[model samples]
Target: MLLADFIRDGAARLEKLYPSPEARGLVLMLCRELLGVTNYTHVVEPRTAVPEERLPELEAALARLCAGEPIQYVLGVAEFCDRRFVVGPGVLVPRPETELLVAEAVRTLQEMELDRAPRVLDLCTGSGCIAWSIALDIRDAEVIGVDVSETALDYARKQFPQGPSFIQADVLDTEQAFPYGPFDLVVSNPPYVLERERTQMRPNVLDWEPDLALFVPDDDPLRFYRAVARWAQRFLRPGGVGLVEINEALGPETAEVFRAAGFKNVRNLPDFYQKDRFVRFQTPDNQAINN
Candidate 1:
């Protein structure tokens, strides 16, 4: 079949799930990956025909898109911090907003005047995007990522030949003994989506993304934030910064969790859209726990 016809038809089929422009973009992206066609291939070569042998492959993937699978999971990768990380079922696809959290982490690690190489701890490090981004950007940095999902740790450990080490551990169990510590920076993009908020999300996310990495009980939305605070308290160096992506509706409450955990200068930070999407906190300078 002609590439133009396929693009038009596949996009129409996907329109049931995505907006008109996004559906077209998804079809174009699929063509680029599978058929080696540019976004304007059909426009430039009106007679362009999808190779006969590859048509079946295109149809199978388009069927997944029509079924409401996320494009990242369909392609098995997500872009974050200007790098692609492998992602699929059992792991949450990295979001663009999470890139801001990585940027702050990279900058914080770069500016630190540490006696030794800076160490970083990434909690709920799905796909290891945050961990790998910070480690690759900074030379000789020691980074460790913690997540409970063995599947997520699998992807995290293999993001690159040489990057952060991934460990399977529950961040919620704050008392768990960790051999690594004194992190110069601690960051996370943990599950902060409230259960009630599920209705507000599109099926591509609510259905495809792993729930373990995306939500919390509506009555206890700040559960992960509290756990993140405790982890930072135990591992983060004195004066070290802690950052966590947060639910915008619970920004002030999320910041309070860190403050209540003895964090100093707890503050809410807005994303590009100016929503309070993250919380930044610091440990008191006078205390040191050299574990």
Candidate 2:
């Protein structure tokens, strides 16, 4: 079969099954992954033959795509903050909205104006997209990513050449102590979507992504926020900052939780869609001692 014929037929099958704007894009990406052919545009310009040996691989990938496995999982990598990281059913595929979370973090770090490398923590780190991005960008900073699942940490650990640390710990455990500071910054994109909302999500997400990394109990959607805020109060240094991605509908309640935790200068940052998507807070600066 030829390349143009392959994309056309695969796209048709995906459209019939998935029926979304992402369907064609997913098929094209799968083609690139399986065929090792980077210049797909030229194949579209004319017609080119796909090697006969490649047909079986393409067919298998298309079959998996039709079965509702996410394209990222099929491809074995997810792009976030303009970098690719390995991800699969055991981990949640990173989303564009979460980039807003990373942006808020970078902005907060810059505003703090520290002269030296800072200590940073990523809670519920998942595939470590946020933690890795910070370490790569800041260069001098020491980053630690913590999650409850060792399998998730394994993928994250493989991405870093040698700088960041990964810890496996439940965030809700009352006795746990964060090893890093009095961290200069604490950031996360913890599970905020209510379990009931699963019916409303796309199959690629609801079927393939890890539920533990995506949903929260409906009764207390802010459970992670509450735990993280309390943890930060204990571990974040004086004037240190905390940030998290949140459900837009919960902005007011999130603000209340942060305030009650004694975090000052609390504010919500909106995503590209103009929804309240993240919150930032800081500990109050200590008063100077007089002579």
Candidate 3:
């Protein structure tokens, strides 16, 4: 079949679930990954034929996409912080906005210029995107990632041949005396989406992404934030920075979780869209030091 014919037909099939532009984008991304074709390959060649031997496999993938599986899952990777991270049904696909948290981390660690190598702890480190991003950007960074899901930790550990270390532990259990600490930075992109917010999400997300990495009780949307606060309070070096991605609707409330934990300079940070998407805070400079 001609490449243009498949693109048009696949997009048309997807429009039953997505808008026109997004449907086309998904089809284009699929073509790029499987057929090694550019977005405009069909347009330029005008008669580029999809190799006959690849037809069945391509059709099977297109069927999966039509079944509402995330394009990233079908492709088996997601681009985050300019690097592709391994991903699948059991893990949350790395979102673009989480890169901002990495940027904030890189900047804060750079500004510290500590005499010793910087240590970082990433709670709820699905796919280890933030952890790996920091470890790669700041070569001397000692980055560790934590997640409760064995599936997530598997993907996180497999992200790179060598980078951050992955730990299998629930971040919500803040009382555990997890041995690695006195970190220079504590960062997380935890489950901030409230249970009530599920209705607003796309099927590919609500159905495909793991609930363990996405939802929180509506009555207590700040549960993860509170756990992060306690972890920061216990393990962060005096004046060490802590940042967490938050639900936009709870920006001030989430920031208060840190403040209530006795953190200093607790404040919300906005994403590129100026929505309050993260809370940046620090341990009190007077806090007794421990490594």
Give me the candidate number with maximum TM-score: 3
The CA-based lDDT of model 3 is what?
0.91
Decide which is better by TM-score, 2 or 3.
Answer: 3
* Candidate 1, pairs of clashing residues: none
lDDT at 168 for candidate 1?
A: 91
lDDT of 2 by residue, 1-291 (tens): 778878788888888667666677777788777776664653656566778987888888889899989888888888899888998779888889888788777877877789988889999999999999888888788888989988899999987587689999998773475556668899988899998888888877887788898899999899999888877877778888889899888998987888887788999888898898889888888721111
**Stretches of candidate 1 exceeding 4 Å from the true structure:** 289-291
C-alpha-based local distance difference test score of model 1? 0.88
lDDT of 1 at 184: 81
> Please, what are the lDDT tens digits per residue for candidate 3 over residues 200-271?
999989888999999999998898988888888788989899999999999888888887788878899999
Which is the leading candidate under lDDT?
3
In model 3, the runs with Cα more than 4 Å from the true position are 288-291
Tens digits of per-residue lDDT, candidate 1, 1-291, equal 999999999999988888899999999999998888899999999999999999999999999999999888888888788788899899998888888998888877767766788899999998998889889988788999999999999989888999788999998898988989878899999998888889899988888889999989988888888888888888887889998999999988999898788888889989999999999999889674333
Off by over 4 Å in 2: 36-45, 287-291
